[model samples]
Target: KEPKEQGDAKEQGNDDNSTEEPVTAISEDNVKDQSIPSPTPPTPPPQ
Candidate 1:
């Protein structure tokens, strides 16, 4: 049997939230873009 090391109990902080913020920001931008109305129409006729 092998003996374990004494200083092997280190804290493992594995928080993977790097991509979440950017994705949420992009989603909010898209929703805001759709929420706002466009002043120009598809086709305009000359008077």
Candidate 2:
């Protein structure tokens, strides 16, 4: 499988989350996928 830089890893991460119960990691990845540097907080995990 491709190394899925970060964005893709996030998708899989979210999917894996529901199965693994790591919502925090999913939220963190969502933030990282947005604006790269603007991965602040309170604005991610809307998907």
> Who wins the lDDT comparison?
2
- Residue-level lDDT tens digits of model 1 in 1-47: 12333233221211235466778999999887876644334234332
Total clashes for model 1: 0
Which stretches of candidate 1 lie above 4 Å from their native place? 1-15, 38-47
* Sequence-dependent TM-score of model 1: 0.42
lDDT tens per residue, model 2, 1-47: 56657778798878876876667778888877876756545457664
> Where in model 2 is the C-alpha error above 4 Å?
1-21, 37-47
lDDT by candidate, in order shown: 0.53, 0.72
The local lDDT score (0 to 100) that residue 15 gets in candidate 1 is 26
For all predicted structures, in order, the TM-scores are 0.42, 0.30
How much is the lDDT of residue 19 in candidate 1?
A: 62
